[model samples]
Target: MERLNGYKHLILGNHDRGHSLAWWLNVGFDEVSEHPIIYKNFFFLSHEPMYMNKHMPYVNVHGHIHGQKYAGVNYFNVCVEHWDYTPLTFEQIRDAVVPSEEQA
Candidate 1:
């Protein structure tokens, strides 16, 4: 994680319970969250995919399932396996959920 640049935020998941919250922060995460957080008012960023249906306007970008997909199109899998071990940029994720024409 130290090799990576920019601000790092860690969202605690089911498998991340071994360490104390302080331990994570001390490792250099800019922000550590125990719960899912909304980004840009629509993206629900979490370690596990939350419920989402086509009727909902928000998108859930999560990673607990690895390469397997959740039920809804609104659920995006950002696990390392799915992304070929490369982290995705916010713009890349935003452009995927919102078409260029709609962005304007």
Candidate 2:
């Protein structure tokens, strides 16, 4: 994290071993949450592809959908399999904003 000079946030998964938000914060994340974390009107970051009301005004950027990415407009899968074992990049997220696209 120091190398990147970036703010890292965490959304704990169902099986995550980390128990305290403060612990994760001390470990380097700028923020941590057990539920989806909303950013601007464009991002909803989460561990699982949370079941939100369709009326939600933001998009979900999530993991836990291990094999296949969801084929929907309101959610973006950051799961490794969706990205060929690599982390999703900012460019990838921008590309994925298109309703019919996913790869980056």
Lowest lDDT block of 10, candidate 2: 95-104
Q: Return the TM-score for candidate 1, rounded to 2 decimals.
A: 0.90
Query: In candidate 1, which residue ranges exceed 4 Å CA deviation?
Result: none
lDDT of 2 by residue, 1-104 (tens): 56545567778887765477877777788878777777766687888776667787767888888878776777888888877776676556856575444332
For candidate 1, list the clashing residue pairs, or say none: none
Task: Name the weakest run of 10 consecutive residues (lDDT summed) in model 1.
Answer: 66-75
- Whole-model Cα lDDT per candidate? 0.86, 0.74
Candidate with best lDDT: 1
What is the C-alpha local distance difference test score of candidate 1? 0.86
